[model samples]
Target chain A: MLGPHAPVATPEQLAAAREAREAYRGGLVAPTSGVAHGLVQANLIAVPRDWAFETLLFAQRNPKSCPVLEVVEPSADGRVEPRLAPGADLRTDIPAYRVWRDGELVEEVADATAAWAEQPLVAFLIGCSFTFEAGLADAGIPIRHQELGTNVPMYRTARQCEPAGRLSGELVVSMRPIPADRVADAVAISGRFPAVHGAPVHIGDPGSLGIADLGAPDFGDAPEVREGEVPVFWACGVTPQAAIMASRPPFAITHAPGHMMVLDVPDAAYAA
Target chain B: MLGPHAPVATPEQLAAAREAREAYRGGLVAPTSGVAHGLVQANLIAVPRDWAFETLLFAQRNPKSCPVLEVVEPSADGRVEPRLAPGADLRTDIPAYRVWRDGELVEEVADATAAWAEQPLVAFLIGCSFTFEAGLADAGIPIRHQELGTNVPMYRTARQCEPAGRLSGELVVSMRPIPADRVADAVAISGRFPAVHGAPVHIGDPGSLGIADLGAPDFGDAPEVREGEVPVFWACGVTPQAAIMASRPPFAITHAPGHMMVLDVPDAAYAA
Candidate 1:
């Protein structure tokens, strides 16, 4: 309903997001990779009104993994538009939406309005690593998963996120194996963007985070570990979803894996 | 009763704080200057347990001025210190304490143990600019107020802080006039330390922030504004103090102006 659908493989970022948004409005379900080049993409979560404050505090305390972009305060008034995407509807902007009841996946819908119809929901747009990944790539650092055309490997680590009231769970991290030489460059580049998940939380040994097996990821596709490459783990936005599942919030909504909300902010806005 | 008294201006930071703490514990009323020469000193606020969350969120949202060092959750069990200072009692560490009730300063006491005695109090240690000031001085930037031997001039501005539930008020800023040539260095030096007030919220044109008179200040001693030197305003820790007064919380405790809790953390821990 916004742009066009099924963007060309190498479409420009905004054009691609607009096209993808258009496709999504027309009931198209697809991942938003390479859609909006140089723009910040975000993970979306919608939860009951009562759980909003605790969730906000949880993200605030553990900002690396769950940097809040826009929090639409929960209200009985319903469906307040966020300023992140102008003229875009939160319920219909993303390619696909997942509805979870009592933390279990109940349905996948193109539009969330139907399931979220009467419920008082607070929507949170969380910073995604896609923007920083663009920075890493711009710096000439290789993104192993991108190179392999697979989802970035994510793991549920032993590192517990700071509990905010009732919301508490283990931190989740997405691993990006970098050539040994580019590790410092990667950290320095990403460290500047605290609004997004900044810098690698853990580098080299996965064992330090209690990540038992690198090949066996809890979420997303595992990437090939190259010679001379070390696995760097950055806090992942999916952390809240895992926390929600563990905390069991009764009802919730999230973007399908890899299906993010494309914001108007350029990825470079987050660069130092 | 921890350290000593009147550290010979150049005593080691830890030794200096120890001396100052000893003097305060011995009921010697004095300002805590040159006490912890290179250590981070904090602004302390102890409020009721029910108001702790809102206060934490207020500080989280208005971080530049209210960068939290550690929040000791209010428990009926009494003062539980953070690792900021081991064996340092929150009740007796600072030189002086201010007690507020129903938004009015009720007493300025030698010790808060009596006023904050038995109630469940949540103590918040907020970052102070002294750490960043150390960095600026390191870069050869002149600290006008420090040189003049006075409290930094603070002003209440028209800028509204992001409110958390009941805690909301106008922003308060501390002004330091930087020589035109060194303003950039001052910003660069301070920006690295976000834990303390980082960078100038307003650099030039005091009118832009709705301050009509440079000579008149809301709090602290007024400094002579030099010609050709730009007045740089940084968010002040006094902001939460003003907010507490405005919000009229049942009871609150704060460090008497310039009398801060000398933390064990060296000033460099805050450096970027």
Candidate 2:
């Protein structure tokens, strides 16, 4: 529910976040970065109650793919009494959402209220890179997307996640090419934080992870690999989404790729 | 079972493991640590199929207390289809066992084949410190118990675990007093390995964890705190067991504390 012609600046994004919760009522901001400085952003997933246990099991089985920040399932009154933000409506917090039916993309909507009923829809919010990006920047590790003003490139890898009941898919990774000498530094910096995606799952050699070409990606934009750099891969939060979509649940809702739910919790809370 | 005169030496301990498994045909080398050099060790919990999910959730919610290494509830036999060391019998792997009924201790025996019924009894092999103790020694971190020739001191702290379905209790911690200068390095080293109870849960003052006196522990021997040392605490495996005991399931089986099942998997498998 981002307003047409609303500025896309970080302040605008923050304003959009407030407006979505305050003025627009369940509206979403365009992009979640810049808007909520130093706050934690999360990738959201809403599934039917019947699949809650399976999804949670899948997350547990494949933690690197889905580092769950929190799992919420509201009672009939639509309030997640204990483990949720005040008035935090899962249906409207994020800027955008994707609806899946039987493993197919059915709709991209702002609100999932119509699709949600008394069936006890479970909501899971996963950790995002927005938190780590701030740390990397402070440590002088430049994030390519911010430099190019584009989205980070994501790839489907041969890495297979530990399967758990109807959730199975190839691992997905986001590529951030770092200078060869700085790879150790990057690992040391990111390694300190595991609540968000921890140290690189794969340090070098894209082919070892079944990535064929650096010029192409299954999602997001292509990376600009420098001469002295190697493509470092970190487990992406999308792996669970891919697994759910592949499993083709009867009903599932996820935040649109890259558009996350901004929470009041600080980024430091996510650090293990 | 160990002989009354069993040396209690590492090799003698391993021979005991082999004998226990040999008693059961196609059995394991009696659950593997102290049997083979650098073999992985595990704590076992066997629950009826009906209670599998709840127990697994308990482990998941209280990870430090019940750090699961692997789950083996084979679909066919309703027994733990041993993986790291197949043909191992959960019912008789460890030298000693405990059976709980409706949240109370029912019996302490050497084997539970009599308790085994046709239905599946899900088994969880959780990681034990015996794995990390080797690493700690390899890193030259002096373990007090090794010197004192006694069991590690364990205390039930005021720290409560995140609860899940009929499972929740105050965290039980194993204390290891370390020199003040080595505390930070010890944390760094242990932090690298999350599977083995990760890093120290409480670093400085034990009082913060509601531990009033170091000389007295709820379980195990009292610590002899040396000068220039601070008592460091690691999340103990007893945490989940305590919670399960409080929850009082209809029936449960656990390896007698300290008598772990040795797996064929190497200790390195525990590292991140």
lDDT of each: 0.78, 0.70
How far is A7's C-alpha from truth in model 2 (Å)? 32
Give the root-mean-square deviation of each candidate in angstroms: 6.2, 7.5
The per-model DockQ list reads 0.13, 0.11
Clashes of each: 9, 9
Chain A vs. true chain A, TM-score per model, equals 0.89, 0.85
RMSD of 1: 6.2
lDDT of 1 by residue, B76-172 (tens): 5566565667667788768788999988999998887777775778788888877777777767888877787777788999988878778988888
Q: Which stretch of 10 consecutive residues in model 1 chain B shows the poorest summed lDDT? A: B1-10
Tens-place lDDT digits, model 2, residues A1-272: 11123223345444544554553233634555444565667778878866775676677666766777777667767754224234567777677778888889888877667666535677788877776777788778888877887777888898777776677888889889998888999888777667677888888889989999978987678889989998999888878778876788888888877677776555665565
In candidate 2, position A213 carries an lDDT of 94
